[model samples]
Target: MQYAQKPELYATGTIQLWEDPHIAKGMLEAHLAPDNDAASRNHQFIDRSVKWLSTLSPVEAAPKVIDFGCGPGMYTSRLAKLGYEVTGVDISENSINYAKEDAVSNNLHINYRNESYLELKDEGLYDWAILIYCDYSVLSPEQRQTLLENIKRALKPGGKLIFDVFTPYQYEPLKESHSWYAENASGFYKDGPHLCLFSHFLYEDDVYLDQYVIIDEMDQVDVIRVWDRSFTVARLQQEIESAGLKLSAYYSNVAGDLYNEASKSLCFVVEKW
Candidate 1:
């Protein structure tokens, strides 16, 4: 296999990792994995996060909530259980189907949409919007602007958007690296034998990328790129403000820990301005 030069920033991958059928299956497994934070945070942390989020929109208020990237409805289901009107949007059909099944089994009424949140269209429909699990850090600047605009359109006037982003502290030890592996059986990357070339890149402005090039026995190749952009409070505030949103409050994390410069992540509640 030929070595690939580092890609330009925010280049689209050959496949959308979250929506690819095989990868989606593996993603669902990772999300449901009780012990790992590979796809979603551990269940215990989720419980705490959901509880803290509830305090933001008490059941007595009967608030309408929209959860972006609601993988398997982990947060949406919990919020629904608290009697909040919940809508979950995701790009993965597999995850949405699983979430729908679980919601039905529990007799919980939730609106689950299998679509990209970047294209969110409901205007002035929700009181609270959540993009948890640090998903906000995955987008490029342009994509982020679009997402914030879409979310702004989706929320009521003065409505709030709650999300988290990693900080430089989270990657203080990250370094540029490259490696490869061969998988002969059904695995995270494929259902059959394939060769995988992996690279980890660190860029200026606290940006990082995990790039994977997968080649099957037939020589078909697929490239997957996962980008993360860490943020400082000032940087995050500027980005939101450019989209007509204002930061209302911030914490070290979604769990409501006090914000500090050394924290690995920063969570914010921003209002449509």
Candidate 2:
């Protein structure tokens, strides 16, 4: 008797898929779904960011703010409503289009651009810059430095830069095994109820890799892999300073508490001198 060889399994996906226009649209819509309670979360985050900004010395009347990687325009809409002239930029054209449509539906005037953050020009025009959702960690050290330099050139003297980063504590526990599964009737209507398996690995000091396998009832499986990095407070501070920005405050939470080693989030408030 002859036995067939078992098939080899390899993680297969493209950065291009994540950057796809339609896929980006679908993902954003899913997050912004009316019944998802995401709207409430958006409002809460915006309220907290606004309160923090209010504590700062007011910028010249009607400060201009830019939201880098403004997915679906959630925070962009919030900031605009708070009276800041807001512009949202993303690398996905589809996401930008969706954001523009969303702004129209909400009757909010926002500038939505389909451009990479690195390509944004410095006209010395902005008063504030924000990179939320731990997005800044996506860049390499050199890219981060370049981004800071660009932000500084884009801001007026004394303008501020605020962003957040994940800490090492979050990664330590994530190195363990984790898995979850869910099933629902919506399967026929959309990407059906599925079972998800997750595996995590600490690739380096600040880098982690997560593999996600989604299996439908029919045994079809789709695997997605994501890689992310965490930044230490000291390393982050050094980058900010090297970029010519002054670190004025650091908080471990959205509510503005002093940062501790174990804090999962490191929110930064830096001013351009």
Candidate 3:
């Protein structure tokens, strides 16, 4: 096995982290972990975020909202409860199923679809489009462009896209590193004994990658690569305007706090031009 080898940029993992049954279960668990920020933000932060989002369009406005990567309806259900017309899209069928079931149990009216947000084709359909939890930072440059275009098409004139991305400060402390471990009990990567090799990489353009190479008892190997591209205000503005959208406002977080250089992440409100 090629241990600690860096693959090409944006190379896909052998197993789809979001779609694979075993990994998806772990991802869902991470998302549901009350205090964990592994997948979704902590519940308290999500509560505050939903409350802040509600204020964007008064409940009386009854605005339409499309949430990309809306895992297990964490934010969608809350927004729906606040009377927004909500539709959630996610690539993980496992997550979508859970979200759909939860919506039913709560008697919340939400449209949940198991599909990549990049496949969104709606044209001028929503008053607000949200991609939270800094999911925007993981996409490749080309993918980011496609996503921006898709979001632009999905929004109505004057509609706003609210998203967040990590700032350079977020990864300031992570240095290039490599490690490995053996697990006999079932864990996040698989259901049986495995040797997991890990590599933390820092690349140009404020990008970082966390790579995992997993080898099972049968010698079957798989790889998972997670990429994060941090951004500055100037870089973000350039990208937003390049997509034919206008950067209306930016903050340190989705909670609408003003941004400062020391902030580790940034939230942006981009309007369809």
Candidate 4:
């Protein structure tokens, strides 16, 4: 007897990282990993980011800031401690709860919202808006444009929007492949006896897809898809300008380091006025 072949198609997103209980639990675990050396995932990077933001001309005076995709209050709490009025927004309820708890424990006054950044409004209120962790790169081109417009609308005149995006150097060398793993009551997929298949695919438009297919003990199958869009300086400059924002500076990794030709990711600073 032969088992039926597994279906191969566009990965259906069911095991959501930001929503499902198991996935959310896994995400929170990743966010709180007790290591600072991991850039973008720990406190050392947060400190570095806050220090770099402080060096920016607009942030030198501690202007009100909006931290979009502000997971676990990493950057938001620090910015608030640095004396900038802060509002943090994220989609994960768990993360937002944790962020609020952190804010209260630190005696930091910060407005934390559990919502989508695409729904952001409150025009002309923020002096600075930031979307870190390469969150902007995961959005579609249209969504990117909308996000920029929303950020622009939310900014005060001359206010700036800062974000980061991975360039070709990060994606060009990534080869598409598939793999399998066993999850026995641990890992991103909990419960017992899960056969997980992982896939990576690249598109012509610099979009990359990372998908997971998991079949659990009771024969329940789940899918999750993550998209990453890569960019070049010229292409990014055009996109920023098209969104009605003025590109002011581009740096390597948000540390205010110069963006050289070989940079894997570049951080952008754009002004609304």
lDDT tens digits by residue: candidate 3, 113-218: 9989877788988998899999999999888999999999998899899999999999999999999999998978989999999999888899888999999999
Residue 35 accuracy (lDDT) in model 1: 79
lDDT of 2 by residue, 147-189 (tens): 7877888888888888888888766665445655575744311
lDDT of 1 by residue, 41-92 (tens): 8888889988998887677763899999999998999999889999999999
RMSD vs true structure, all candidates: 1.2, 5.5, 1.0, 3.1
What local distance difference test score does each model get?
0.91, 0.70, 0.91, 0.80
**Best TM-score among the predictions, by candidate number:** 3
Q: How does candidate 2 fare on TM-score?
A: 0.76
Tell me the lDDT of model 1 at 195.
93
| Alpha carbon lDDT at 257, candidate 3 | 85
Better of 2 and 3 by lDDT: 3
Which residue runs of candidate 4 sit more than 4 Å off their true CA positions? 1-12, 34-39, 57-62
Better of 1 and 4 by TM-score: 1
Q: Output the TM-score of candidate 4.
A: 0.91
Between prediction 1 and prediction 3, the one with superior TM-score is 3
Clashing pairs in 1: none
TM-score of each: 0.97, 0.76, 0.98, 0.91
